[model samples]
Target: MACKCGGYYYTLNVKASFDRDLNKRRKFLLRNVSVIRMFTSGFFRSKWRSIAGKRRILRLKALTVSLKALKLAGVHGIGIEVWWGIVERFSPFDYDWSLYEELFKLVSDSGLKLHVALSFHSNIHSNNGKGALSLPLWILEIGDVNKDIYYRDQHGFSNNDYLTLGVDHIPLLSGRTALQCYEDFMLSFVNKFESFIGSVIEEISIGLGPSGELRYPAHPFGDGRWKFPGIGEFQCYDKMDDLKMAACREGKPQWGDKGPQNAGCYNSVPSGVPFFEEGKENFLSDYGRFFLEWYSGRLICHADAILAKAAKILKKYQEREQTSVMLVAKIGGIYWWYQTLSHPAELTAGYYNTALRDGYDPVVSVLSRHGAALHIP
Candidate 1:
């Protein structure tokens, strides 16, 4: 069958043998199989089925050839990354969905389910050595790069980091918070592809942070640059972070006006110190716990902002179209867990095998409250 969308047409072909093979496997397993063996087989079979489904989704960019291949492999779903930069590259509220419309039509014609990943940052390598920004260049031009808008690394370098569209700056258009602008983008996205929401596009994975993973830029400084000390240093020391710290220290005059840095509270050593000494008073204090929670709370706020906007959009669509569409939030795993410099337990009391030593519960709590699925990849 051929599907047409905005001056483009594609044909879809499904191989019949794939369906036959799936049925054959199912029947073979059910025929006089032992209960334990049947259960084990079923569990592994489901896992393989999910893996195949995701593989098919990830190959959606290949178009007709991919659809045919996925069908032959007994895969029924496909995922595609929709670049925010490309979609709204020209200007705010000005979008071109020609490419996506074509892809959706192809998926619909192929009778396959779809998952859409909304990517706001790019890890694409360019000639400039700075990773490509998934945000529109014009948006970056409006923000103050010198401020805490962009992420900085352990060495206080901000060269290679991608600018976060919703967090790092004010919206290009007036009278809108960054969160509201992001929500408006989601609404526009759903409106543009409204016809396919409940049909072909079964899920929308919202990109809450860099590389579509929900966490701070753990290694934002990039690889082989600054080696981490005995304990991983938090990189969110920009003006905005400093402001947040100031707020945390408002009632507590004992911590001083500068928060952790005021009293050499970070890593149990004074600022500019490279390493922490064992059995130091600052090291044994609850400073690490307070910092962990403070940093984690900041991350959770960002995650909440994005997820809340996404939930609002999904709810609007559900009510308007009378169909359910799933929302998925991608959570990044512990980026510093495997560091060879120091064991996480030895470095700080609150450290763990999670992002920035901040546990995943805070992020997960927001996702659960917003009715979004947690995707840890």
Candidate 2:
């Protein structure tokens, strides 16, 4: 069985807890980092599906027992995904934490700590096309009208999985920027959960990009356009024309509207791939240099803006509570074609990292300022 969220799958492999001495010493600055693992559970799937349009926690007693069992078995805690779609699903700024409140209370009573993630992405359907959780309806409605708000490839195909980095600061979300929407979600959470911050909550993971990780959906599945070993298409552009191109298209009309064309397929031999080939005059060309830089720069700006907002909000809570409420940001792993000059997969995933250029440095430098730990999921 697979745990699916926002068109991605995760395997639970947590094998340890946050160091007890570190927790006790409050030496968060010592910065001995541990990976913050999370679980979504079956609760989300069945919670909203009660009859008569009602939402209920099915088998409350059983859930209570399970939490107690985990506590007694020496489990550390659980990661509760406070979904943007569910909380503010109906309209802007109207957050509903009803189900999460109950779950959190149960975990608290069971004496387990919490690793909370503000999941700002959607969950796609199963193979049977039954699952339905996704971005907020209001946001999706706007995307329906202005397709440029979401990320798409050169083929004019786009996804509403998560809003694209193209429109992070764009005032398209009913007069609110996408970054504002995310910040508001965090502000509401901090204000709502004051009672649990230092006591039960260990860390707050802020989702910065797709699948709750800070990266473009470069090699997205179910689109039939990508698969393993493929170079993956650039997701910086949208399906719309004449709109502010997501990656910007001014003064470079000669570069044309399309992205790198001869790039390798989802599964291609490194030898025959023209775009990624050495001295191929495609990826190393002036146009490739320009587009890749602009594409990746947009992503970095998105991350920088969001982290600045998040650090400001969450750091205050840490000061008031006199506890270390760490902020975590996740970036996807892009290791394909590392041996090549282009590093096609990395470039498409909002990383300009390659033999010719150092990309992660700039992104990590931004993270260091906000005291955020980056997790590669």
Candidate 3:
């Protein structure tokens, strides 16, 4: 097929080209041909056949493929991922923009948008900090190893010394102060990419860590600990209190008010610390915390925050340019979604039922309407 632009014509070959000038040509192909094929692949060929069910499943698959391809090609807005340790490593006034810059540049050059997984721990930091994916070992000196305690708990999971020191639990506190450091990192992120972010990037996903066995005890609410339902509930350690005081007294803090907000937090929910129990039942009992937290907190609250922030920022940015980008949140796993994360199957099933009650399908539909898709396994 071919499309006419004014007086010129361009060929439309599904596999051969998408460079046509008229957006209609591409849109037509996607609606008619691409969607039908995807539907057939899942519905007709598969034994689980029901006309209505097939239609729904087909729409879902088409949507999934379309969204993934669009984000990858930059046709869509952007997709986000998390990389927490990076920000924390140079937090409190400094930043390492190289990692993000590289990613942004590649996306920009390709005419695609970007969404950043702001910050979180990675395998490099997980495997004693010497593995292929480890953060540049230098962060050990920069980041307060003490705060790294978030990694270890009775849950048998280890996010800190286990990676850097080659052992599971090792107390080595000493790095930047807390709130100041965290704010510094966030500010640096927002500032460094201030121009490129809302302009070129679509969303930013802040990871709380995975819901796997390696992480537990850090559950934000259900199990207590650092449960901050609102800024008022936050426990102000000496450093955090000092920062608030300094910001209030000096009148120079970047974060307005220099204090916590009434907005709730979802960090304490899933520890992402692993459980090394030998039996499946024990593992389920331990890992169940993550499954529940993922459904209740991570997918609901944390994901909502990312989307709301992205929408607010992107909308304001677009107001000037008269162009709006979609806000796609990189959310956590579902019941089945966590199987790959090594969550117990029973826990996964339980989460699935919870998802049904929580209106997960509708949430995904809402995201689709907004030019976004909540990730699933």
Best by TM-score: 2
Question: Cα deviation of 248 in candidate 1 (Å)?
Answer: 5.1
lDDT of 1 by residue, 314-353 (tens): 8855454555677877654443423332233223322222
**Model 2 worst lDDT run, 10 consecutive residues:** 7-16
**Predicted model with the maximum lDDT:** 2
| Candidate number that wins on TM-score, 2 or 3 | 2
Model 3: lDDT to the true structure: 0.34
Q: Would you give me the overall lDDT of model 1? A: 0.50
Candidate order by TM-score, decreasing, is: 2, 1, 3
Q: Which stretches of candidate 2 lie over 4 Å from their true place?
A: 1-54, 125-132, 239-253, 265-269, 320-322
Candidate 2, residue 252: the lDDT equals 65
Report residue 230 deviation for candidate 3 (angstroms). Answer: 34
Candidate 1 vs candidate 2: which has greater lDDT? 2
> Which stretches of candidate 3 lie above 4 Å from their native place?
1-91, 125-148, 151-156, 161-184, 211-315, 318-321, 334-373
Residue 219 lDDT in candidate 3: 32
